[model samples]
Target: MKVVCSYCHRLLRESPGEAVGVSHGMCPECDAYFAKLWGGLKLGEYLDLLPVPVMVVDGGGRVVAASERLADVLHRPRAELRGLRCGEAMACSRSRLPGGCGKAEHCRECTIRRTVDEVHETGRSVAGARAWVKTDAGRVPVTISARPAQGFVEVTLDEPEALAGALGGHAPPSRR
Candidate 1:
């Protein structure tokens, strides 16, 4: 098979094969070029372009990137939200406890943490998992969806009522 650069149409390599065919793939040059181009964009900046409230959580469940929509809902600056655990970012009451964030006992049963962890562990997506995040204001009901993206998980938050209505009045399944 002959491997050719999909972007520049440059011949990359040829391998022994019974079938004569061309495989389209990005060459090192094109890959580096695009990587450099995209590398110019900050994670938060790229995530802010998303329409919905979304956040990128690293393996440690830290908020590595957050969209402007999420920041607005959290009432915090996007830059400040970075490096915070999901619980802290969402203002979960347990996060304020002595151990803080994931260290608290309630962290084990936390839907948001569990959903994100499940997606990371199983490499499967969790959609519309209902969760009640206890904040300083009160217990706020929300629906969370998470998908593994590269080495990070992109978690989206939506209003429970809004998601329920979108799902034909049926609440999404709990992914405990």
Candidate 2:
């Protein structure tokens, strides 16, 4: 039988010989799921999207691709964020890590971080994620999404300006 990974939620493909009395023909559902999961995460060249900040990681969840938007949301340099640990990149310093976001440690309690973790577990794409981030003014809701990014995970922040624009204020121009 084609099994879904409880850890990553990815579908396990069963060969004809392995299919036997379990699942029927090739599982197209799982195949499609994998496609969307991976495509949505791939970054840089493949898709020309809006200015929303995006962060992509590998299977290990390391930061791989970070767009202009991610840098703004995280309040860090885009160049500095590349190749850093996922936890470190988003959290920045020790102050931003475990218990950095909420009562729970490791940002697991943070909805955006949790969505990314869920996508990693399913090997599937997580979409339309909306989160109320804790900011100086108050809690601000921002939309986001997660997918596989080649060897890493890809996440895009949406409508972040409307809710928490006051957090960072404005973004500088990028030549690229």
Candidate 3:
């Protein structure tokens, strides 16, 4: 069989279809050279090093992928969050207002519901989105950053108070 030579840019013969090497003959020297030139040797290790919680969200803001850190925040196994609506998973259904009106009263009207829409509207990634997440305990403030990743969108959440301090702004004292 004939195979193209990587370095020579020409076709050469292979015995029973042995792949050819750089410009000359198939050899360990050429294979090593090519691998060294273009190969990701440590890609897996790099991904494992990320410390932040990473999440993949659909255009409708449903969680598609989430990291272990998110499990800690939501108090559930990471697998349990898959396919759940973002609003429902965040416990927004149960939040209460000063009048004791629950999330059933107005969660659909919350501003954070517009987050992904805003991203799509501006045609750009968003950073520093302050949103309310209702927990079993109560409503909580969170800061979000979002961008597209691997054909899907990604969002990350951080504590609003910590984010505010990092940005040199003060978090409003809790009213409760």
Candidate 4:
């Protein structure tokens, strides 16, 4: 049988007398790397270690945890972001409405909300979906990606040139 690293997809080995079929396993290098990076870390800590802006949201769309990068991108403290709805964390103008966040009528069409909901409901990932969010600073364009993780959904945001000015002329770190 053929064995490949599940994390990096690198070929490990092929048993001489076995049938030719791929089997997934972690390569030693990847195993050690992941162990060093995530061995004893909790979910929230792991999120912070990621380079890109990411947040983990519960089924109700409340942020359970967020990366420091996300807090930086939203110009809010990490402590303030937790337990708030996604729209509220992003400072969506409509999120401050009488009903708040997801309760606003305009929220029904929110791309980030819809992406998270779809991933949670279907256990599928949505990648690089373009969205325009109406924030206190006005509408900003962002690329959103979401994937179901355990019982929650992990959402990532990519703001291109739009946030450069807000970030003091430096572009947000690359997702890669």
Residues 1-176, candidate 3: write the lDDT tens digits: 45555574455655664654433454455667567546654422322233554466676667777765554455556778777656654555443443231235564565555666566455578888887765554566777777766555666665535433433344443322
- Superposed model 1: Cα runs more than 4 Å off: 1-40, 160-176
Highest lDDT model number: 4
Arranged by lDDT, best first:
4, 1, 2, 3
lDDT of 3 at 113: 54
Per-prediction TM-score to the true structure, in the order listed: 0.67, 0.54, 0.53, 0.75
In model 3, what is the error at residue 53, expressed in angstroms?
A: 2.1
lDDT of 2 by residue, 98-137 (tens): 5543223635556666776778777788888877665455
Preferred candidate (lDDT higher): 2 or 3? 2
Q: State each model's CA lDDT, in order.
A: 0.80, 0.60, 0.56, 0.83
119 Cα displacement, candidate 1 (Å)? 0.7
User: Which model is ahead, 2 or 4, in terms of TM-score?
Assistant: 4
Least well predicted 10-residue stretch by lDDT in candidate 1: 167-176
Candidate 1 residue 25 C-alpha distance from true site, Å? 25
TM-score of model number 2: 0.54
RMSD of 1: 9.4
TM-score of 3: 0.53
Highest TM-score scorer: 4
Question: What local lDDT score does residue 5 receive in model 3, on the 0 to 100 scale?
Answer: 56
Model 3, residue 51: distance off in Å is 2.2
